[model samples]
Target: MCAVSDDVQISVRKMDMRYRHETLLKDLNFDVHTQDVFVIMGESGCGKSTLLRHMIGLTRPRHGDIFYQGKSFWHCGPEQREEMMQHFGVMYQNGALWTSMTLVENVALPLKQFTTLTRRKIKHAVEFKLALVGLDGYGDYYPAELSGGMRKRAAIARAMALDPKILFFDEPSAGLDPINSKRLDELLLELRDNFGATIVVVTHELDSIFSIANNSIFIEPKVKSIIGRGNPKKLLETTDNPKIIEFLTRGERYE
Candidate 1:
């Protein structure tokens, strides 16, 4: 077991992933510090989402192990994995809220599944989570009744239901407008400041990256590996790699 540190919540070493003969990621290594907003950005098919899956244990690495709180999750038994998973909350690219369930019911599902709390207690907990995401009074609405941004907020509320230590968001602003995207970014900052939750976001949005990322990693498609890692502003100012420069100054002409 690796030594645990309050700052380093997740550590990945020499990780590799492949499907049959096609390699997706190679020699990947990174660490996510506690209460830090770590954004992973890359072009489509560069394996950003795949990396997120591996980090969250939805998929296992073909060659390397992932460590959570200094424990090797891939090498651990089912019970151990279960124990580790309880510390994580994941928000998918599409929000993934249940259409049939009301917002409150969706937020309360995780607690219901994992805890023995009474309905009243669960309701109270759910309300707290909804409030955290600025959805305090919309608990009775179903997914179909909410707007896109509202759906994303409701999804975030559900993800927080269990009070996870680490929150993973896959393209949290995928379908939202600029205004809503900024709101989500603000919510992320609030989450880190108020709850001290470590956030790992997988996004390619330039605005999102510049606005919220404290530290970031860039996956390069050609290398099928991480080409950059550091503060987004620092990387943008120093890196002359055409791709990195292009991505950093997405809408403006380089000349």
Candidate 2:
């Protein structure tokens, strides 16, 4: 409901995530609208990252389907799914950059693998992606040469190399100090507002959950379902559920 537009970008219907016979999540249904900063937040063991994996085609749901523009992702052919995945930019919990590569080489990997662009053009594209993430002149730097935040930004540049429509992030702020986390949050909003990119983030950082997410779902591991949904600030103001309130308040008494 916090979405500015009613246009649904991704839909998860009757989804169940399981590892073998043990169900991790059940009957999960949600809609991520176009341009939404949709946060998936919960306690550590909940299925937040698992749900992200399901959405991105890295893992298949044990039951039900995930749809993009009404086409079933899980039920699609491998070729079709690979095509869909090309347009999705994912930044994992770790920056995932190869220490042996420079930023330019790292960013150019996707373009080289997926497109027919010449080496010169690929370099040009890589520079643009780096600039987009505020890393304009760091192209020659290796992952070890940068700070943690800068490394994360470098990873983001690589993810954006293909010009993805929907960007997915896993705990983007996990290792940052408060100031760096806030800067990362600002960059995410800039991506959403300036480029109209739809974003899905898996994070439990309340500061970020409130700062960036326009819409969200809080999954509870014990219940194996979503226990909270909507804007984090609004949920803090309006919800009476103890677990949710406790979560939003960091277990302090909410007036």
Deviation of model 1 at 210, angstroms: 1.3
How do all models score by TM-score? Answer: 0.92, 0.90
Give lDDT: candidate 2, residue 191: 82
lDDT of 1 by residue, 93-184 (tens): 77899999999989999999999999999999998888877788999999999898889888888888887889999888887877767878
RMSD of each: 1.9, 3.2
Q: For residue 158, give model 1's deviation from the true position in Å.
A: 0.7
lDDT of 1: 0.87
Please list the C-alpha lDDT of all candidates, in the order they appear: 0.87, 0.87
> Which residue pairs does candidate 1 place in steric collision?
none
